[model samples]
Target: MPYKPIESYGVIGDMHSVALVGMDGSIDWCCLPHFDSPSIFAAILDDEKGGHFQIVATHEASFKQMYLPDTNVLLTRFLGAEGVGEVCDFMPIHRDKHGNRNGIHQIVRIVRAVRGSIHFRLSCRPAMDFARREHEVVLLPEGAVFDSEGQDVILLSPVPLKEDGKGGVTAEFVVEAGSCVTFALRHADDWTARNDLLSMAIDGEEARSRTVQFWRDWLSKSKYEGRWREMVNRSALVLKLLTFEPTGAIVAAPTTSLPEEIGGVRNWDYRYVWIRDAAFTLYAFLRLGFTEEATQFMEWLRARVSEHDGPSGPLQLMYGIDGRHELPEIDLSHLDGYRGSHPVRVGNLARTQLQLDIYGELIDAVYIYDRHAKRISYDFWCDLRRMVYWVIDNWEREDEGVWEVRNGRRQFVYSKVQCWVALDRALRIADSRSFPIDRPRVIAARDKIYETIMALGYDKERQTFVQVFGENALDASNLIMPLMRFIAADDPRMLGTLDETLKQLVSDSLVYRYELEKGSGLGDGLTGKEGTFSICTFWLVEALARAGRHRQARFIFEKMLTYANHLGLYSEQIGHSGEALGNFPQAFTHLGLVSAAFYLNRVVGKE
Candidate 1:
């Protein structure tokens, strides 16, 4: 079988859920209600038996897909020798007065004939519970229905759909110029309720038009009328698509287990929100005039920080949509993994680890919130102050680093710098509001941490920062030193670190998190190679721009943007072959794109 590279997928979503549409016009991964939910269509893992929703031209054709100008509406065109046809895919937003988000998600694929004629093939094979249960199939005049184990997939198609066996349905029909074909699948607990196809069609179309307007209106408010506007806007749209509108929870990525390495065991589930990326996301959202998202995230952060009682232990690394804590890791041994990367796993096991840097992330987010949102309750300030005190007491302790390495714990330089950041931001907040903190102690901790990291993490021989004390390997996490203002952007040490990282960690101008050979050190106890870290690359671009290497920064930035699929979407890592790996349409990656684009746009001229 022919395998399209993983980067061939395009993403479509309403705030509540998302689907990955491939170049072959198949939705191989989709989770209903939320990004973390069980998949309704998961053929991306098991190509043959796992379910998928596909709409393709019956005739042999070459395919191309792009989003409508400045909108999330995807237009996929199939061009064959005899004719041409297009499939316009979008998930219409349910909105209300004042633009408050509503909870309904609708995927509309409007098939239009652009030339003489084209035959269309429509099939929806939905495998629930990972294709384990047998489904009761029913055929209707309007379409086919499959009821399996309390989950129902009702297909509304204009053409007659026949059961192709094994809980699948297929339809082949012809359309001429000016003709249209529409299909929709609605998920409900009950399969007996009659579906109104005419209303669904009308509602779907209306939703599409409204969604386009919503996106266009959102982009219109962007202050980013600079160089690379198209790329920046596309990245912004993808970020918006990944955001869960109702709760203001932004997922790390839409689809999970895309794998970081091919046939290598570096796969991870990235459907949950990470504190590691929260502060940066706040900055990106605020930069784009997206206050609602920032506000929602800040609220979520407050809840997370407040829930864990005292600060002696590690902060929660990530959480479920409503902030549930228990993420029991599991491996699905039944299905062969994506592209023969075996042992498909779900529920990240890293949630329970002690990553010290999250304290810095939490503090930074709160500081920004204080600046943007009004002064919150004094109780909130007190809670923040206590958290800072906890960091000061515990920063010296060894814990899992930012990468959440699975081997063993070491005093990671990045973790130390962020601990300093926690104290620094807390000091700023306390001083700004005149809240009393042990001024000397906070300053002492800050300076001591800074000096300690510089003394230990820096390698005089290499003239660049190392991953840990007494280690020679370079880490992309050090790229944030200049971006975070921990060091002067042009400091000789910073320059050397950047150069060293470029030479070691970067691949074709993209960045990886760190050398896998070093071992992550947290000990979930697995070993394998993964994709180049997406956020690390953006950090490199930002550090480069800050260092006054605008030309190199701009080139790398533009080149990195090309890694995005046609819809301007990115995964967690770029594989060795440039295929998107390790989760589809990662939020952290999209946020990095937005942030780097803003900086690059400011420095470079309109291109």
Candidate 2:
């Protein structure tokens, strides 16, 4: 009916794609066949024109949603005054011994009555090619086939179904306390015969058990036994779900064009992988003993490092989930945005930006993963070495920083700090493993970079680092100096920077990304105002913890935890009214959560 809050949806995926099932029992958003495929249901972006598949009680009821413990299987319950109904939603996880996805996907929903009599309505709407292509509906004896040209979406069930006047299928039935109903929404393939699809609905119970076991087995490999285990485990699950298993490249988030500022023009697609986000996710996985993902992305990274050669460097800021380089931006002006946020968009244009900070994030990940999981071959080492040389040649260049601002490039201090990190970690790896490197040149360059930053980057009068080496506006990114090991946490200069960040960029215990105040015309390219940055808040917490302000760090950490949705999921930012303002279940926010939690737990326990 109306729009659901971004945080009101729970995610279930087969590691190839995910569907956002709302608390009201509607699959409001999903991309079938692949993570980047056209949506079959997109009501999250457009309420009326965008199609949806929903299973709900006909009677009014209060709803509650949760994940099955330690798994991504979601359960949504409708509790009415007279009866209660439950829907168990999951995508069957089918992976072979070698971990291949086998190129087929399905969303199997098993519904049951948990209490007295319940009346349920089930509707499966197909909006092919983002609701642009029309589909021909062929009704089966107990199911229906929606064919948008030759591509078919087969929906099968035990109950009888009929086509509504609109281009969709609908069914209504009543179930007693012990009865059950099943629905399977599948991506049609030549191999999946219609009878086999029917049998899938018949055996939904076995499939549910297998899916649950798959998640549990994957989660069993985690090595974290620290405080806040529930929230930490949920973050781990979010990371796992966001990962596109076929390529091992995790998408930043599933749904796209959900605005950073509602009704503002800040919306951009996040259903693609960014080098910085994946690198942080790798660190989170390695911290919890998930070495397989670490190993998989290393193979994925091998392809990315050699794919492109732009003017600035070899790598772009982000890539498609399947590792495609060309992501041409386009606007989908047909569908209204979520809550009428205008001009819904599909592909991201930011991928073309020259964000030099990615080198430090990616190289740092490889360095850590090599030490923990497996040894890097000389070929992989060479790729990393190429990245280091490029950074050395280009560290003095001004370009887009980690935030990917739209204004013209400036000498962002954070970008320079990461350039230093790239060289520092590369030197450490070379020395540790006897890898051949230009040791003299590397050392000279690293030292010079350090000297230059301390001189130009730091403001002597204010005793703090500036946003762009010349401007005076405080940035939460500069707090990353200690986290990146560029400066000692308690260094005199860093102490002043930390204090200034708190004073300028923080409100109500949450951290803003940067100042909108005009120091160097920072807000020139930005759209309307934005909310507090979710990841930056965690960065502040980690920075404070490292600086030995343990009490304030813990207070801020606990307060930020309260902002997560009921299912322990976080969007990219929090609005002024505390609503989720950006894409839901953001990878960057969860990675920051794990990083801060891992460091905070260890440091706090020692005290």
Candidate 3:
């Protein structure tokens, strides 16, 4: 089989984990049990050695794929000279009446013929632990089981099958109109537990209907009745899927090591939650009236802060879905990386980096939630106050900025601005709620940050704010100044900064996070170039809309929407040729989409 393009895939999840389903009817990337679990099928990363499960047409067929309306249920249709067939793929949502999710992790696929007789082939190849562990296949009366040391993958099918002689299973069959076959890939700890989950026969039709209803009901809670409904809803659905429902921690993306530059060494694992990303995610959710999600995330954030014993402060940059602190980075040398992007990495090492901007993001999210969702508990407020003091004490120090640049830290202007944001929001919260605190100290610190930034961070000669202090290079992140209310959007300084950024960091409306020109020393400690950042492009859209450039913002916003994949999904970046680079269905990109769409609609609607 040939390799599929990164964007030629759709994703489905049970809110605990996700699987990447290709247009050619194959599951190329799926982490078992949880979002951070080791891959069981990873052909997307290593097509030759990584295992996969495929239900493909026997003969050449043209394909069309889409998600069922308002739901995550995916349908891929195949049309050939012989017949027409469709594959319906979804993960069943087993929720109780109380609106809590049950622990059912499975991917169900139903193959059915819609026209004349059609022939199909089914193949199941399980590579446990990223193909590092050996497994034994045990044939069962109902299906087959691939059992490793601690994990068991059960493949239950209602068709006859034969061993492929390579420790896998394969089946070939033909179906006429109105005929259908069902397959379920269930993951469990052992064979006993696997059998228990399979004991109850799942009515495929009933499960599909219920899953669709579950998504529709959840989406109905959205209060966004604005323009671009389809695109906005699709972005919302992707965000929902990326969220780890158990802990309310949203992973940045499901798959890891998808290169930002093809064959470049820039790939890093994104299957963990970052404080900045999660906070922005909460802000987006709140904008759409999804207060329940916002409140849940606030609870999660409070727990992370209260349980902190580390000297690094209240939180790390990122954490595992279950709030595990230690995420050691490792390389999978055995399996070749995606497109041979060498040294496939797992577990991000950036988690331990001191990213001071996280404090600002965290505090800002709490303030937004308090006003838009609900009141913060007194205990939570006390914890936030301590976090504020930490910021006040350490605001002058330099750390990794929002981009998580691997190069040695400098006095990033964005970081200092966020520290100002932290103190500013804290003061507002205190005054509005009359919370007891050191108001005088907070006010003085906030003013000090503003003064320092204006004095050192701004470059008078360039008439713009630079990427860092004492430099002339521009960055798209500085565009957040007006959005954060650090400066007025139409202020002369902000307008100059915006124009300089568009000139230096933008190419045809697509924005780069920063310039990597030689001798600029701002390549982020990586080799090779990268695609235009989708999030930064959307940031530009938001900045333009907020600056009263309504016509220009609408033009760029509409053009950017055309870059999304056929299913209205976005990866982290877009190559020069308009191909999606980096991890697929990135949460940050989608959050940007949601936010830009919301603000653009409001601004354009008023006109």
Candidate 4:
């Protein structure tokens, strides 16, 4: 089989983990148990060694794929000259009467002939531990099981199957119109547990109905009834899918090591939860009236803060879905990387880096949640107060900014501005709740940050705030100044910064994080160039709209939407040639889309 383009896939998940299903009816990327679990089928990263489960049509067929309306149930239609068949794929959301998702981890596929008789071929190949560990296959009455050292995968189907002679299963079947077959891939700790669950025959139609209702009911809670409702709703759905329901910690993306530059070494694992991303996601959920999600995340954040060891600061930059702090980076030397982008990495090392800006984002999210969702508990406020004091004491220090630049830390202007945001929002929360916060000290610290950034972070000659102090280079992150209320959007300084960013960092409305020209002395501790950052581009749209450039913001926002994949999904970045370049279905990109749409709609009176 040939490799599919990164964008040629749609995602389905159970809010615990996700699977990337290709249009060709193949599940190329799926982390079995959790979002960060080792891949059982990873042909998306390495087509040759990585395993896959495919149910493609035997005859030559054209494919059309879509999600069932207002739901994540994916339907991929295989149209052949003689017959038309469709495969509906979804992870059943088993919820109780209270609308909480029970821990049901399984992928269900219903194959049916829509037209005449159609022949289909099914292949079930399991490569446990990223194909690094070998497994044994056991034939079962219902289907087959792939048994590994610590885990077992059961593939159950009504169709007959034969051993593929390569420790896998293959089946061929024909179905006439009105006939259908259901297939399920389930993970278990042991065979007995798997058989116990499989004993209860899963009704395909009932499961489909339940899944559809779950999504529709959840989406009904959305408060957004504005222009671009479909796009905004879809982005919200993607964000919800990326969330790890058990902990309320959302992964940046499901799959990791998808290169930002094709065959380039810029890839890093994004499966961990970055505090900045979680905060932004919480803000988005709050905006859409999903207060439940915000509350869950706030609880998670409080727990993480409580676990902090004082001197090391409030929280790590990122953490595992279960809130584990130690995520050591490792390279998978055995399997070839995506397009041979060398040294496939797992477990981001940036967790240990000092990213001071996360404090601002986290505090800002708490402020939004406190105002819109619910009141913060007094105990949680005490923990947050410690973090706020930490920020006040360390606001002058330089650390990694929002971009998490690997190069040595400098006095990043955005970081200082965010420190200001932290104190400013902290003051608001204190005032609103009548909490006895240190008013004078926090106010002085906040004002000092603003003054320092204006004096040292700005380049008077270039008429723009540079990426760091004493550097003339521009960065798209500085555009957040107005969005954060650090400066008025139309203020002469901010306008100059915006104009300089538009001239240097933007290419045809797509925004780059920074200028990456060689010998420019601004490399981010990595070789090769990268794509236009999707989140930064959307940030530009919001910045422009805030600056009263509504028409221009709408134009750029509409253009950026066109860059989303056929299924309205976006990755971390978009290449110069307009291809999605990093992890697929990135939460940050979709969050940016929702934020941009919210602001643009309001400015254009579509709210």
Candidate 5:
């Protein structure tokens, strides 16, 4: 099979891990057990070697995919010359009494003929450990089991299977209208064909009904009744799926090594949780009235921060879902990257880099959470206080900004502005919540940050803020200054900077992070070009709407919506030709969409 476009897939998850189901009824990319677990099928990255499970029809047909209304259950329809058939795909989500997702890790597929008689072919191929490890299959009367070194995966179905030319199993079946088949792929437990397969398959329909209810019940917490309710709700659903429920750590995306540029060396693993991205997601959750998630993440953040060594700050930039901090970057060179993008990478090295902006993002999230969700415990306040002091002491330091550029640290303008934001929010929290803070010391440090940014970060000649303290290069991240409340949106300086960004960094409603071409001399210490950053484009929409340019913001917002995939999903970036160029169902981009839609819709509704 050929590689499908990144956007040609819909995602289904149980808040632990996700699977990318292609339009052709194939499970092309999935990391079982957990989002960061080794891939069970990575055929999207290397179609020849990586394994996939497919249940496609035998007859020639066109395919259409959609989610069941208000739920993550995906339904793919086969418009065939012989008969009409549909496949329902979902990962069953079982909730505890407290409404938390605590269930088995599995994928359930239901194949049914919607019209006349239809013929179907089922293929099950398992490639453990990102397809680098070999496995043996044990055929059974109930189903088949793919046994790896120690981990085993079982595919339980009602049909008979046989080994194929490749080390996989295949089956064929024909069914008339009103008939169906069920398949469940899950991690092996004590249950076997004699004990559980029959009952599990029998419970497939009940499980599907339960999973759909779980999602709908969760989505009922949304308070948004906006002009683009569907889009906002979809983004909310994507954010919820990316959330790691066990610890409340939200992943940036499920799959990794999906390049920012096709065949370019920009691919990096995003399965881990970054503090800044999670903070952004927190804001979205709070806005949509998902306070339970916000409260859970705050607890996660407090516990994670307590584990950090108290030298420079209270937390690292990112961490594993289970709170592991030592994320060493590794290159998986054997498996061909998506579209042969070389040197597929697994851990993130940027965690070790000094990203001072995280303090601002983290504290800002705390402030919002404290205001909108619930009061923070004194213990949580103590953890945040240490981080505030750290910012006061180190806000003048040069470090990676929000973009996490590879270029050697300079006095990035965005970083300094965020430092100002950290102190400003701290002051607000102290006043509002009666928390004890070093009033005089923090105020002095906050004033110094603001003064330094205005003097050195601004370029008087260009009438705009520059990327670095002493340079005039424009960056899309500075578009966030007003949104952070560090500057007024309609201020003359901010307006000038906004114009400079549109002229220098934006094209056709898509915004690039920074100039990638060397002639611009804004080198990020990386080679090759990249797509327009989708998160920043939404940031622009929010910024423009807040600036009172309602018409311009609405137009840009509408145009960007066209770039979404058929399922209303977005990746990290958009390629030059409008293809999704980075990891699919990106949480950062989805949260941006929610934020933009909320702010834009609010202001427009008032008019």
Candidate 6:
């Protein structure tokens, strides 16, 4: 079987973990129980060895899938010569009476015929521990059990499932109008359940309805009355779905080892939390009235501050789910790479890099919380004071920028701007709340960062801010300067930077992070090409909108939206042939989409 293109996959998750459902109705990638846990079905990574669970119409059938309106319930319709059937796929949102949440592990797949008649073929193969551990199957009277040395899988299905080779289960049934069937799988480490099959089906249906209701109710609170209502809503939901409910930490993307450059070595595990991703994620949530998510993430951020000491040499760029500092990067050699993308890596090495932008990201989140939440305890302000002081001390240092380039550290233009942002936001906090802090020190830090960035990071000949001090190359990160108000969008230097970026980084209406081949030096170590950075493209759209180029911005914004795969999703980058590459459905990309759409609709509305 040939590999499915990246865009052909849709996602379904139970808050704790997610599964990538292919257009052909096979679950090629799924991590059980937890987002970082071993995948039960990983054919997306190793098509031949990695096991998969597929349920599809056996005949010459065509499928069309979409989410139920205003809900996360995914419905895929299959039409063949004989009949038409619909697969209702959803994970019930487990919530308390007060409307809070917990880890969602169970996925309920129910199939029913809407018209004629369609035959469904079901294959359930639980490849434990990345398909290395094999299991022994036991067929019980009610449910089937697959038990391995350290893992277990229980089949809670309406019909009896026949055992196949290597602990697999297979079932085939025909469903006519008004006929329905259910299949549910739950994972645990040595466990059993006395589940009544009929009641489980009933519970699944109720949970599905409530999950949709929960999303619809939460979405109703959105403060955005913008023009791209559909796009914004979908982006908001995707962001919500990616969040880890137990820890309140959001992963960069759901899937790991999705190649940035196909058959290349740009793969990195993104299941861990990055302070940078979460910081911007907070703002996106706040905009959509997702106060619960925002509050949880802010608390998660505060926990990080409380645990760590001052500065810590430019805080680790990312952390484990429980906020652990040490993330030992490793490569899974056994599993063949996604489309022969060699050396499938797990855990990110960039976590150890000194990305100075994190300082600005943390300070920005603190400022955002202060602005929106309005009440900060004295203790919280004291922590803020320490953060502010640290920024003043560390603003001038050279470190890796946001891209986590492994090359030698340079005075990146975007890092300097963010250092400026750190002080700027700190000043806002001190003034608005009248908190006791060193005012002159902040002013000094702000002015120094501002002056140095302009003097060092700008190219006078090019009339724009360059990627690094004394360089002529433009970076997509420069687009954020205007958005951050480090420079006005109308400022001649800022306009020139935008123009230079368009001339250099953009291709086919998309933007690259930088000249990977050139800027990525030999001593930097890693080698590979990648797709256009989705966030950079959105940043360009935002910069254009701010520069009073609304028409051009809207055109570009709409064009980028079209790049989303079948289910209105985006990854970190778009490959050369427009495949969704990098980590699947990255948060940075979706967050950028929301911000860009909101601005485009807003500015265009004024006209």
What Cα-based lDDT does every candidate model obtain? 0.79, 0.87, 0.88, 0.88, 0.88, 0.80
lDDT of 6 by residue, 415-517 (tens): 8888888888888888888988888888988998898887888888878787777666677888988877788998998888888888888998899877654
Those runs of model 4 whose alpha carbons end farther than 4 Å from true positions after fitting are: 98-102, 310-312, 518-520, 605-607
TM-score per prediction, in order, is: 0.94, 0.97, 0.98, 0.98, 0.97, 0.95
| Distance from true location, Cα of 95 in model 5, Å | 3.5
TM-score of 3: 0.98
Where in model 5 is the C-alpha error above 4 Å?
Answer: 96-102, 189-202, 310-312, 518-520, 605-607
Query: Any runs in candidate 6 off by more than 4 Å, and if so which?
Result: 96-104, 192-202, 310-314, 518-525, 605-607
Candidate 1 Cα misplacement greater than 4 A, ranges: 96-102, 191-203, 310-314, 518-526, 605-607
What tens-digit string does per-residue lDDT give for candidate 2 at 1-607?
A: 8999988888889888899999989999988877788888999989887889999998899999999999999999999986999999999986679966545588889899999999999988878877888988888875888877645788877788888878998999898998888888888744355456645544678878988999999898988888877888999999999998877998888888888888888888888999999999999999999999988988898898866477558888898988887788788899899998876888888887888889888888988988998888998888789888888888899887888888888888888888888999999999889999998988898899899889888888878898887777777888888988999999999999888888888998899988877576685387788889999999999999998998889889999999999899999999988889888779999989988998898888444
lDDT winner between 2 and 3, please give it.
3
TM-score, candidate 4, is 0.98
Question: How far in Å is the alpha carbon of 596 misplaced in model 3?
Answer: 0.6
Clashes (N, CA, C under 3 Å) per candidate:
10, 0, 0, 0, 0, 0
Q: Candidate 4: how many backbone clashes? A: 0
lDDT of 1 by residue, 121-211 (tens): 8888888866676787788766777777666667777888888876788888899987877777766555344354323444556766888
Q: After superposition on all CA atoms, what RMSD does each candidate show versus the true structure?
A: 2.6, 1.7, 1.3, 1.5, 1.9, 2.2
lDDT of 1: 0.79
lDDT for residue 458 in candidate 4, whole number 0-100: 92
